[model samples]
Target: MRIVDTHLHLIYPDRFSYPWLATKPRLNWQPWTHEAYFAEAVPLGIETALHMEVDVAEADIMGETEFVLGLPRIAGAIAACRPEHMNFVDQIEQLSEHAHVKGVRRILHESPDDLSQSDLFIENIRHLPDYDLSFDLCLRDDQLYLGVALAQRAPDVTFILDHCGNPIPNGSGLDPWRASITEIAHNPNVVGKISGLVNHCDPGWTAETLRPYVEHMIEAFGWDRVLWGSDHPVATVTGGTLTDWVKATREIVSGASPDEQARLFHRNAERIYKI
Candidate 1:
């Protein structure tokens, strides 16, 4: 089956400034160029990819999008944005003008809880539907309720929940994560992205180790509301390779019918991201 990787991050330190990489030594080794990514991705059936923003410095956000959209097999981009800023409308205006810029993301996992909950933040997020842009919610497992609140307020906008709500595969946080995901999925406008599980797992993680989380996500959101994502270099740095993640994801969901698999692998991505 052809795969549409909805969360590929291509880094270039020479051309961009990623201050966050300083705290993540593993991912800061060198630039994770598109050439290095596609060498392995193409063989694994990833025919197209959406370049997810790498949280580069504000000055380089648009630059990163422009550069990656020019790379081979990169179907579109999920550029970064700061909804709290007064210039957010300008940012979305510029991004929406680009045909290949499918959506925008603000890394809320490490950010303060109140950051996205503010009135101004919610107001800016509400503006997405005007440009026909979706928002990728990169929230931690515990922060999922905030996602629920954001999704509810912006019923007109489509929200892609990244990393299956970013739960830990170790099972300790399973109960609450499941509860939160279930609540979030109740919103018809929200979709789940099956990516980044490897980043939250230990080195010895296997397909079986990831099964529960993946299955629950699909169960909650149903097949049509879920899509596939590689989470790429971050997955590699954290625990596994893009190849391992693809294999494991397929293995876990193998019981589903071909149509169901197609939706998760590529079909839903095409509909959700409009690539």
Candidate 2:
């Protein structure tokens, strides 16, 4: 099946400051340019990709989008933003001018839970629909309810829940994660990304090991609301290569009907990100 990687992070250390990479040596091995990603992704059936922000320093947010959008086959970008700030509207307006800026994402998983609870954050998020931009929700498993709450508040804004709410299939965490998934799926505005699981799962994780989580996500979100993401270099930490994860992901759903596979591989992403 053809693939549209809804979550692709391209890192350019020389042009942008990625302070988080200092502690992530595996992902810091080199900058993951669009050229590098396409070289690996093209042969594996990834026809297009939406460049997910790497959480670059605030000053470089627009610059990062500019750089990635210049590359070939990058369908669009999900940019980083500070919706908690009162000035988010200015940033949103500037991003709206760029056709490739498909959505906005704030790395809320690392922040305090109350960060998204702020009135300013909620207020700013409500304005996204005016610009027709979506939000990518990147939260740890425990923070999912907060994600659901945010989506509930801003019914106008489309919310893409990243990393399957980061389920840990190998541990006891599945029950709670599954519960959150059930709740999040109820929000018609929320879409689930069937990715980053490779990064969260055991290093030697297999397709069978990932079946329960993947199957449940497909069932909960329904085929049309689920999207696929490589999470790329981060995924490499657990699955060895983007190609390997694609293979494993394909195997995880190997038994599904062709239509189901098509939706996860690209159709859902096309509708959600409009890429």
Candidate 3:
């Protein structure tokens, strides 16, 4: 059960500035270094990982990428980018110079709805293919349609839907989330990441609570289009452990064929991120 974690975030307050963590007291209280992560991860069959960007300050973006790629088992990094800016091409050009930069992500989950809907943002996203980069879409449950719209406009670029569209598994948003996921998968350009749900779940959530959401995503995107991620310290923010997530995922997909399991756990991530 080897895993390729596609959404692991490492925090380094000394090296970079993560202003958003100010509001997230739990995560901000300590740095989540690779050494701390791999101690638990290695035992659970996580071999390698891609360091997802933590939305560091604009000044520390490239520096963060360079720093993480040097860590052990970090196959690559998903660096942060500002597609809304006019100089986005220049930014990607700089990011493209580093072979470890597998893709780029602009945190759309917390930003204003129109942040990524602007003409400039769409135009900038269209340029990703030029640098051989993918985009990780981190939208909230309500903002799932925005992901579909962006995928439609940038058919050439690969879109990895983070957190199974970051669904709110509170029972009410299920049907609409399922519809949006199906629509997103229809584009052929978007893939789904099975991570981040623990943060959205209630304290009492279990594999059964997450079964429907996970099943719908796999059904819509198919095994080949979906991959697993730890979401690490963030996963721990909601009283969920990395080990618990891995074990729960293993339980939920226990009936799938080994080949199908391989695709979801590691194969798709290796191919999609070029890891």
Candidate 2 lDDT by residue in tens digits, 206-252? 77777888899988999989999999878888647888789989998
Tens-place lDDT digits, model 1, residues 177-261: 9999999999999999999998888797899988998999999999999999999899986668888999999999999999999
lDDT, ranked from best to worst:
3, 1, 2
Q: Distance from true position, residue 149, model 1, in Å?
A: 0.6
**Comparing 1 and 2 on TM-score, the stronger one:** 1
Please write out the lDDT profile of model 3 over residues 1-275, one tens digit for every residue: 89999999999998899999989998999889999999999999999999999999999998999999999999999999999999999999999999989999999999999999889999999999999999999998889889889998889999999999888876455878888888889989999999998888888679998888889989999988999999998999778899999999999999999999999999999999987
Minimum summed lDDT over a 10-residue window in model 1 is located at 168-177
User: What ranges in model 3 sit over 4 Å off?
Assistant: 171-173
Q: What are the models' TM-scores?
A: 0.98, 0.97, 0.98
